[model samples]
Target: MFKPAEGPVRLPSGQRYLGLDLGSKTIGLALSDTGHRIASPYQTLARKKFSADAAELQRIVAKEGVAALVLGLPVNMDGTEGPRCQATRAFARNISQLMPLPIALWDERMSTMAVQRMMTDEADLSRARRAELVDKLAASYILQSYLDWVGGQPT
Candidate 1:
C-alpha cells in the first residue's frame, strides 16, 4: 500500500505511526497506536551522526511497531522552503534508505513556540524545565496536528 504526505494514507492497516520533530540538537518522538486515535510523546534523542541517529530510529521503529513516519517540516514564515527545510528533507531521504516506511512532512512553523507557551502557561514550568521538555512536547504537537487533520478537522 502507498501513503501520501498528507490526507488518508493506506498502510498495512495494523501498524502504529511514528512522528518525528527533528531539530538541530534533538529529535522529538511520538507514537500512535494501531488504531491511530491518539498520539503520545515518546522520547527525545540527542543529535548525532546520521548513522548513529538512523540506528537509534530503527530501534524505536522496531520496538514501537511503526508503520509510517511523520516528519515535521520547518518551513519559513512565508511558507517557503529554506535551508532548514532542505536539511530536513535531506535527513528524510537518508533515513528512507535505511527504513522504507512512508514519510510525511507536516508544517511545523510554530510548534516549538506553542509547546513552550503551553509549558509555561499550563504547567507553570521554569525556563529550564520548558527547554528540557520542549522537543518532545513539540513532537506531540506535531503528531496532534497531523492526527487532527487526518480526522478531517479544518486547517
Candidate 2:
C-alpha cells in the first residue's frame, strides 16, 4: 500500500508551491514564488476523473519543481467544515498518496465571493466572464491568504 508523503521540507530559500481550489466542475490553480511572497493564478482545469486529474497535476509538479501543495478548504461562515470541505480533504488525501507532496489546507471562506466582487467592481466584467474566471481568481485568493498567514502576516 502506498503511504502519503511527508510534510514539505523546509528550504533555506523557500521553494515554489502550488495551490488548488477544487470545485465540483473545475479546479483552480495557482503558483507561488520561490520566496513564497506572491501567488498568481496559473490556470483552471476542467474537472475530470481522479486519475486523469492526478496525472495532469503530477505533470505540473514535475515541470514546475513544486515543493508542496496548498489546498483550499471550503468552510462555512461559522468556521465549521462542510460537505465541500470534506470533499476537498478527500481529494487532498488521494493526491498525497499519488504524489507524496506536502499538502496543507487553507481556509477559503469568502474567497469566491471576494473574487467575484473584484471582477465586477474593478474589472467591470460581465457575469459570464466573471463566471469563467472566478475559480482561478479564487485559487489566487486562497494562495495569497496562505502565503500571508505562513509569512506571519495578517490574511
Candidate 1 C-alpha error for residue 77, in Å: 1.1
Cand. 2 Cα-lDDT: 0.84
Q: lDDT by residue for model 2 over 1-155, one digit each (tens)?
A: 32333443233455778889999999999998888889999999999999999999999988887988888888999998889988988898788888877788887989999998889999999888888888888998998888777777333
Alpha carbon deviation, residue 14, candidate 1 (Å): 3.5
TM-score to true structure, per model: 0.91, 0.89
- Candidate 1 clashes between residue pairs 3 or more apart in a chain or in different chains: none
Candidate 1 ranges with C-alpha deviation above 4 Å: 1-7, 153-155
Computed on alpha carbons, the lDDT of every model, listed in order, comes to 0.85, 0.84
Write candidate 1's Cα lDDT for 1-155 as tens digits.
Answer: 33336555434556888889999999999888677778898999999999999999999999889988988999999999999988889988888888988888899999999888888889999988887888888988888788777767443
Q: Could you tell me which 10 consecutive residues in candidate 1 have the lowest summed lDDT? A: 1-10
- On the 0 to 100 scale, the lDDT of residue 80 in model 1 is 98
